[model samples]
Every structure is written in structure tokens, then in C-alpha cells.
Target chain A: MIELQHVSFERQGRPILVDVDFEIDRGEFAFLVGPTGSGKSTILRLVIFDVRPTHGVVFVGEYDSQSIRESDIPHLRRRVGVVFQDFKLLRDRTVYENVALALEVTGAKRSGVKRKTLSILSAVDLVHKRDVYPDTLSGGERQRVAIARALVNDPFVLLADEPTANLDPETTDQVMKIFAEVNARGTAVIMATHDLRLVERYGRRILRLDDGRIREDMGLVKQV
Target chain B: MGLLLAFREAFRGFWRTGMVGLISIATIGASLLVLGIFGQVVAGGYALIDRLQERVEVDIYLRDNVHRRRALVLARDIEALPGIAEVNYIDQKAAAQEFQDMFGAGMLRALSQNPLPESLRVRMTPGSDLPQRLQAVSDVANSNKDVESVDVGETWVGALERFVQVITGIGLLLGSVLCLACGFAVSNTAKLMVLAQREAIEIMRLVGATGSTVKLTFLVGGAMQGCAGGFLASMGQSYASDWWTSRVPDLALDPTIDLNFWLVVLGTVLGVVGSWASLNRVLSAVSIK
Candidate 1:
């Protein structure tokens, strides 16, 4: 579960996210629809505890952003998966290694890393591409690897930031289907995106952001 | 397994950095060699000074016209003295033998008479080389009727020891400053190599890796550099010392001085501390989100 209560973030002299409040419960998929600079990424950052709220509290499960110690931030991160439009995959590593890195960070044993990484890669339809490096993979494949990496540790919540921005339409749909399946499997998903069609096609719960304010918290007619 | 991964990562880093890693190791080894040699020279100087100090003792010359029986009795008294550790009596014939040994048979054959005097070479107690003790021992020998004069050289070894202390202090200070400077320069260059590559450390921290876990990789890398550099430097030191010893046979050097182990220890400290400094500076500024 993630909550942002009356959170306001300012960078330099400009306001980013002003007096924002929202909550997405466990096993729910929420789309964060917003224009550029509407603070979608900042919300994800707050969830990841990269930056504390200037005036309000952001909560990720039991961790309070304002009160979490630096030493405990890594533990908090272990329970959440984050994906980016850029893929954020280590280019030199093979798909399996990149995914295994997720498990490795948490001090997982070798056998567990192998098993979990392979299982997650298979779930994302990337099992065949396990031995290939990210630079050699297609955009969609790279994005899938990122997703597999994010999911390898079985994070309770997933935060995706425009994961399909640089992806082709067909790949975008494939990526969306992966998210849909992940959400169906009981992992909460909060995706920030500029794609309105995804919001319409997926028809899940949507939070529309305009000028740092949440304009709409609309629930879809049929949830995936 | 965690340690294995850390070491693998470290080796991967070393390989990825290419010439930077080689240059770092080379520079580290060169500086360590200098430090090792400096240590050896300082230690050698101290040993030489100690040997010379140990040789300092009082010498009592017997009256030239005095009876040999009285001289033998005075020698026994000097031996019984509290501070007198050993007494070597030089009778007229033994004194002439020493002169002959020094001057050679041909040179001594030119002399009309034996010029060497009967004397007692008095070595004081092992640690009783204090000026007061030396003077007291000399005074006891001087008061003897059979003794003409006693020579203690006014405890000049004390001044030599004080001088050696100053030199040792300077050597330590200079060595420390030089080692620190070299370590800083090399670590900075190594830090650049680390940052020049993809920021793997940031990624490592992003995915739930603890700070110590992330640093473990870098620490292992630095330690490897240190050990390798230490080995190279020790080899260089051995070669240089050997070359110098061959050229300057008069200079006494301790072949058994095991500075290799110490060099490795020093190299380890330099590597770990340098990498720690660089990693802390870089890692602290990065946001782990």
C-alpha cells in the first residue's frame, strides 16, 4: 500500500507536487495520468523514499518517508519494484544477471537467485532472452527485462514511470498486458504515464493529474 | 557467496578500468617501494648507532714503568667494579702483538722497541652507559696507583643517540606525508576510473543493497591492488638493495630484514583507506532511489 497525504514538493523556486493526497490499496492497479511536469515521477520518487515530502507525509507500507532512517531505506526499497521508460537495466549484464541483481541486492542465496530470476523472466516472456545483454535486445525486450528485474524480488507494490514511452505500440500493449497480469496476481501497481489510450484501454482505476493537483480519481467500469 | 560476488565484481571493475587499473597499481607499487627502502635505511641507521654505542667503554692505561704484578692486581679490581662488565688486560707482549697486527710484520720490524702500553680495556655494564656511570667507572680506574690515565671520551654516544632520534623523527614524518600524498593522487585517479564506467555502484544501492555491501566490492578491489602492488614493490626493493649492496660492499645491510610483509600491510592500508575516501565521497552524493 502507498499513501501520499497532503504532500507538497518544490524544486528550486518552482512547486512540483502541491498539497497532493492519494492512496492505492494492496492488489489494486492505479494509473497516474498526467501531462509532463505534473509531478508523476516525483510521486514515484516519494514512494521510493528518495525524497521526503516538504510539508506532508508519504507512506509506503509501514515506512513513513519523513521518519525513515537512511539505513532502513534499502529494506523499504526491497519491497517495491520501480520501472522506468529508459529501462534502467545494466547494459553490460545479460537479462538473467540483471534480474538476478534484484535478488542479489537482498543477499539472496545463489540457488534462490537462479530460481527466482528464471521464474520471473519466464513470467515476463523473457526466459528465451535470458543470456542476451540489454544492448543487444529490442526496446520491448529490454523493457521486459526491466520488468522481470523489478519483479524478481517479488515486491509487494510496483511503480512504473512511463514504462512504454519509448516502446512501440505493439510492445506497449504487451507491456500493459504484463502489468495487468501482475496486478491480477495480487501485486499492487501504480503506473505514471502520458498515454491516455492506456488509461482508456486498460480501464482500471485512474488518477488524473493536472498542474500538480489530482483532478480525477475515477474507477473503471471493469477491473482487470 | 556474497564475498565471492564482491570479489568477482571487484575483479570485473579492475578489468573494465583497463590502463587506469594498471597505472594505479604501478604508482602504488613505486611509492610503496620508496617507503620500504626508507624504512630499511632508517632501521639500518638505528642499528649502526646502537652497535657504535655498545662499543663505547673506558680504557685505562697502566703506568709505563710500573711493575706487571701491580698492573695485574689493578685489572682484577677493575673487573670486580659494579659497572665494569668486562676487562681485557693487554700485557706488554699482547699489546705488541696488537700493534704488529695493525701495522703489519714489515712495519713493526722497523720499530726499535715495543711502543704499545699495558692497558685495561673496560667494557661497562650492558645498560650502564649513562654519562654518570661511565664517569664513575672511569674515576675508579683513574684513582688506582698503577693506572696513569682513564679514557671515557666524555659520553659522546649520548649526543650521537640524540642526533639519531631527531633523524628518526624526521624520517617518520617525511615518510608519512609522502605516502599520504601518493595515496591521495592515485585514489583520485582510480575514482575517476570508477565513475567513468557505468554507475554500477548506484544501481547496486538502488536495489536494496546495503551501503556496506556496495562498499565491499570496492574494498575487495582496493585490497587486491594493494597486495599486488605490495608484491611488485617488495621485488623492486629487493633488487635495488641487492644492486646497491653489490656496488657498495663496505655498507652493511641486513639481508634478513623482512620488509615485504610490512610493505604488504602498508599497501593494504593505503588501498583500503584510499578507496574508502573516494567511495564515501561519491556514494554519499548519490540518491539511492
Candidate 2:
């Protein structure tokens, strides 16, 4: 579960998030819809304890922004998977190595890392491209690899910031299906995007952010 | 698993930064090579000084009226002194014979009577303070009524001691400055290597990688580069020393195996320290929180 209570973030005295408040229970998929510079990324950053709120507190599982030590940030990250718009994969490594790295950083056993990485790669339908480098992959494939790397650790929540922003409509649908499958298996997902059409198509709960404030929160819509 | 991952990442980084890695290693190697050469020069200079010190002996010439028995007693008394290692009584006949051997029998045949005085050839201990201790021994020998004069080679021995002191002082000061410069060079090169991989490091931190794990990766990489530099420097020093000795046999530099081993170890330490310093500055600037 994750919660941000009356959180406000400022950079160089400029307000990024103005007294924002939100809570998401476990196993839920929600869309954080906002245009560029609307503080969607900052919200996710706060959840991962990458940056502390200028005022108020954020709670992700047992970690509190106000109380968590600097050394415990890595442990908090292991439980919260993240995917970026640019698909931040190490270009020098193969797809398999990129995914395995998530587990390796956690000091996972070799056997567990290999087995889990292969399983995640298979889930994302990227097992066949496991040995290829990211530079050679299609935009959709690169995003899928990033997703697999994020999910390989079986994190309770996945934070995706415009994960399909660079993909074509067809590739976007394919990547959305992967998120749907992951959520179906009981992992909460908070996906940030500026695309309103994509939010309507998914028919999921929406938290529309505008100019550093949460303008509206539409409860979950039943799929047609 | 942590250690293995560190090693793997370190080697991967070392390979990934190809040209930068090579430059770092080369910088360290060149610095160490200069240091190694200087070390050998100092070692050789000390060796030569030691050889010169070994030949230092006091010649106490006895008067013409002094009997052989009395000269033998003087030799026994000088041998009992603190710094004296050995004292041999060279009687007038033996001194005459030695002079003949040096100038040939013809020079001694021209002399109607032997004029060489009986002397006590006194040798000091190896580590006894030169010039000062030699002066003390001369004073003690001169006090004997039968002795006419004492020759302790005071001027040359004092000059030799001063030379050793000057060389040692200069060697230490220059060696320290050179070592600090080399450390700075290696550290800056390592900083560049780390900066080149800055994005990768941020991603690692963004993931679940602990600070220590990330540091270990760089530390291991730096140490490997340093070790390679050390090996190169050792080889370079040996070859250069051999070439030098071939041209100038008097300055033969024979650095022991122990010295080479320590050079390699010093290289490794420098690499670790450089990496640590770079990591501290870069890691602080690029904080995740």
C-alpha cells in the first residue's frame, strides 16, 4: 500500500506539488494523468523515497519519508518496480543481463536470478530476444525489456512513468496488455501518462493532475 | 554473491571504459616507473656509500724511539675501544715491506735504512658515526706518548657523511612530492572514468543497489587498473635498469625482488585510494535522495 498525506514538494523555492494527498491500496491499477511539468514524476519519486516531500510525509509499505534512513532506500526500491519513458537499460548489457541485474543488486542467488529473469522475460514475450542488446531492439521491445526488469523482482507495486510514450498505437496496446496481465496477478500499478485517450481506453481509475495539484479523482470504472 | 557481483561489474566497467581505462593504467604506470627509477638510484647511492664506509680505517704512526713491544700494547688498547672493530699492529719491518710492495723492491733498495714508522691499522665498526667517531678514535690514539701522528682521513670521511645526508634528504623530499603528484593524477583519471559511467551509476542506485555495492564495483575496477600499472612499472624498471647498467657498469642498479613486489602493492593501494576519493566526491554530488 502507498499513501501521501498532505505532501508538498518544492524545488529552488518553486512549488512542484502543492499540498497533494492520495492513497492507493494493494493490487489496484490506477492512472495518474497529467501533462508535462505537472509533478506526476515527483509523486512517483516521493513514493520510492528518491526525494523527500518539502512538507508532510509519504508512506510506502513500512517506509516513511520522514523516518527512513538513507541506507534503507535501496531496500525500499527493491519492493517498488519502476519503468521510465526512455527505458533506462544499460546499453552494454544484453536483455537477459538487464533483467538479471535487478535481482543481482538484491544479492539474489545465481540460480534464483536466472530462473526468475527467464520467467519474467517469458512473461513479457522477450525470452527470444534475451541475448540481444537494447540498442538493437525495437521501441516496443525495449519498453518490454524495461518492464520485465522491473517485474523480475516480484515487487508489490510497479511505477511506470510514460512507459509507452514512445511506442506506436499497436505497440502501446501490446504493452498495456502486459500491464493488465501483471495487475491481474495481483501487483498494484501506478502508471503516469499525459495521454487522456489511453486512460479512457483502459477504463481504470484516474487521478488527473493539473499545475501541481490533483484536480479530480474518478473512482474505478467498470470495463464494458 | 555481493562480492562476485562486485567483481563482475568491476571487470565489466574496466572493459566498458576501454580507452579511459587504458589511460588510467598508463598514467599510473608512468608515474610509478619514475618513482621506481628514483628508488633504485637512491639504493645504489647508499650501496656505494656503504662500500666507501667499509674502507675507512685509522693509521696511527708510532715514533722512531717506540719499541715493537710498546707498539703492540698500543694496538691492544685501541682494539679495546667502543667503535674499533679490529686493530692490527704493523711493525716497522711489515710497514717497510708494504711500502716496497707498493713502489716495487727498487725503491726500498735505494734506502740505506728503513724509515717507515710502526703503525696501528685500526678499523671501525660498520655503523659507527663517521668523521665524529673517527675523530674520537684519533684523539684516543694521539694521547699515547709513543704515537707521533694519527691519520683518520677526516676530510674525505666528513664529506662522504655529508653526501649521504644530502642525498637522503633530497630523495625523501622529491619522492614524496612525486608520489603525491602521481596519486593526484591517478585519482583524476579515475574520476573521469566514473563520470563517463555516471548515468549507469545513477541507474544502479535507482535500482536496489546499495551504496557499498556500487562503491565496491569502482574500487575493484580501480584496483585492477592500478595492479596492471604496477606490473607494467615493475617490468619497465627492470628493463630500464638493465639497460642503464649495461651502459654504466659503475651504477649497476639491482633492485631486489622484494622491492618489485612492494611496488606492485603500492600501485594497488594507490588505485584503491584514488577510486575511493573519486567515489566520495561523485557519489555525493549525484545523490538519489
Candidate 3:
């Protein structure tokens, strides 16, 4: 579960997020839709405690922004997965190595890392490209590798920041379907994107953000 | 698992930054080789000084008419002196025999009579004030009625002492400067390696890896480079020592295994420290996009 209580974030005298408040329970899929500079990524960053709230508190599971120790940030991140638009994969590592890194960071056993990494790669349909480096893969395949890495840890919440920004329409659809499948398997998903087409197609709970404020909260509705 | 990961990441980094890693190793090796050679020179100088100190003795020559019994009594008196460790009376006959042994029997045969004087060889106990003690013993011997002259080798011994002091001072100053340069070389290597892996490091931090985990990776890499450099330096030192010994047989220039092992240890420590310092400076600037 994630909650932001009247959070206000400012950077260099410019307000990025103002009085923003929201909550989403476990196993729910929500789209945080907003235009450019609407502070969607800042909210995701806050949930992971990458940055503290300027004026309010954020609660991610049992870690509160007000009291969380610096040493506890890594533990907090292990339970929350994040996917970036650029795919953020190590250029030197193979697909399997990249995915296994998620488990390796947690000091997982060798056999367990292999098993979990292979299983997650299978789930993301990237098992055949296990040994290939990220530089050689197509845009969609790289994104799938990134998705597998995020989900390999079985995080409770998956925060995606414009994960499909660089992919073609067909590839974006494939990526979205993966997110949908992951959500169906009981992980809460909060994807932030400026694309309206995705908002109309998925038709899950929508939280519209504008000018550092949540403009509207559209409840779950039927898919278009 | 954590240590294994650190090693794996360290090797991976080495492989990733191929030439840069080699450069780091070579830099450390070169620095250590220079240091090792300097150490050998200093060690050799001290060894030579020790051998010379052992040979130091004062000789009190007696007048030609002094009786052998009187020479023995003078030896006993010199033995009772404050700093004298041992005193040996050499009569005219024994002194002549020594002269024959040193300059050959033909030189002694050329003389009409045994002209070498009866003498007492006095050795002093080892102490910081060796030159002064030798001077005091010489003065006491000169006051004796039967004594003709005393030779303490004062001028040469004083020169040797000054040489020891000069070498020690120079060794400390040059050693400090060399060590600082070696540290700087290692620190620059670590900085370059960190810069090369900037993206990977940022990604690792973002993926929930602990700060220690990420740091351990780079630290291990730096240590490996340093250790390899040390090994190389030790090999070079051994080779140089052998060449020096072969060319100059009188001087012993062998480097012990213990010295080599210490060199490697020094290299490892420098590697770890250099990596830690560079990481402190660079890690802060790396932020998640």
C-alpha cells in the first residue's frame, strides 16, 4: 500500500508537487495521468523515499518519510519495483544477468537467483534472449528485460515512469499487456504517463494530475 | 553471497574497463618498484655501516725499550678503562708476524731488526658515544710513560658516523615523497575507473543495492589491481637484486620473501584507501535520473 498525505515538494524555489494527497491499496492498478511537468515522477520517487517531502509525509508500507533512517532506504526499495523510460539496463550484462541482479542485491542464493530470474524472464516472454546484452536487443525486448528485472523481486507495488515512451505503438501495447498481466497476478501497479490513448484503452482507476495538484480521481470504469 | 557478489562485480569491472585497469596496475607496479629499489640501497648502506663498526679498534703503540711485561701490565690497565670491552697485548714478535702476514714475509726480511712496536689493541663497548669513548681512551694511553703514540682512526670514524646520519635523513624524506606519489597514482586510477562505471553505479544504487554493496564492488576491484601491481614490483625487485649482486659481488643485494610480501600488503592497503577516497568524492555526484 502507498499513501501521500498533503505532500508538497519544492526544488530551487519552484513548487513541483503541492498539497498532493492519495492512497491506493494492494492489488489495485492505477494510472497517474498528467501533462509534462505535472510531478508524476516526483510522486513515484517519494513512495520509494528517494526524495523526502518538502512539507508533508509519505507512507510506503511501514516506512514513513518523517522517521525512515538513511540505512533503511535500500530495504524500502527492494519491496517497491520501478521501471524507467530509458530501460536503465547495464549495457555489459546479459538479459539474465541483468534480471538476476535484482535478486543478487538481496544476497539471494545462487540457485534461488537462477530459478527466480529464469521464471521472471519466462513471465515477461524474454527467456530466449537470456544471454544477449541490452545493446543488441530491440526497444521492446529491452523494456521487457527491464520489466522482468523489476518484477523478479515480487515487489508489492510497481511504479512505472513512461515505460513505453520510446517504443512503437504495437510494442507499447505489448508492454501494457505485460503490466496488465502483472497486475492481474496481484501486484499493485501505478503507471505515470502523459499519453491519453493509454488512459482511454486501459480504463482502470485514473488519478489526473495538473499543475502539481491532483485535478480529479476517476474511479474504475469499463474499458473502451 | 555478499562477498562473492563483490568479487564477481570486481572482476566484471576489470573486464569492462580493460585498458584502464591495466594502466592502474602498471602505475602501482612502477611506483612500488622504485620504492623497493630505494629500500634495498638504504638496507645495503646500513649493513656496510654495521660491518665497519665491528672492525673499529684503538691501538696504543709502546716505546721501543718498553719490556714485554710492562706491555702486558698496560694491557691490563686499558682493560680496566670505563668503556673498554677488551684489550690484547701484542709484543714486538707478534706485531712483526702481523706485519709479515699483511705485507708478506719478504717485506719484514728486508728490515735489519724487528722495528714494529709493542702495542695494546683496545676495543670499546657498543654505544651511542663511540667516537668520544675512543678519544678518551686514546688520551689516557697518551699520558702513560711507555706509550709512544695512539691511533683511534678518529677522522674516518667521524666521517662514517656523519655518512650514516645523512643517509638516514635522506631516506626518510625520499621515502615519504615516494609513498605520497604512489598513493596519488592509485587514487587517480580509482577515480578514472569510477568515472568509467558511472552509469552502472547509478543503476546499481537505483535497483535497491545497499550503499555498502556498491562500494564493496569498486573497493575489491581497486585492491585486486593494487595486489597485481605489488606482485609485479616484487618480481622486478628480485630481478634487479640479482643483476646487482652479479655485477657487484662484494655487495649483497638479495631481497627477502618477507620484503616482497610486505610490498604486496602495502599495495593492497594503498588500493583500498585510494578507492575509498575516490568513491567518497564521486558517489555523491551520481544521482538517479
Question: What is each candidate's DockQ, to 2 decimals?
Answer: 0.64, 0.71, 0.68
Candidate 2: stretches off by over 4 Å:
B255-257, B287-289
Please give the CA lDDT of all the candidate structures. 0.81, 0.85, 0.86
Taking the true A–B contacts (Cα pairs closer than 8 Å), what share appears in each candidate?
Answer: 0.65, 0.77, 0.54
TM-score of each: 0.89, 0.93, 0.91
Number of the top TM-score candidate: 2
Query: Whole-model lDDT for model 2 versus the true structure?
Result: 0.85
First chain TM-score in every candidate? 0.97, 0.98, 0.98
Q: Per-residue lDDT of B65-158 in model 1, one digit per residue for the tens?
A: 7887787788787677666667888887898788778877787678897777888887765442456677776777778877888888745677
What is the Cα-based TM-score of model 1? 0.89
Worst 10 residues of 3 chain B by lDDT: B251-260
Ranking by TM-score: 2, 3, 1
Worst 10 residues of 1 chain A by lDDT: A215-224
The local distance difference test score of model 3 is: 0.86
Candidate 3 residue pairs that clash:
none
Candidate 2 docking: what grade?
A: medium
Tens digits of lDDT, candidate 3, B29-146: 9888888777776666566655566678999999988988888877887777777778988888999989888989997798799889889998876655778888778877888999
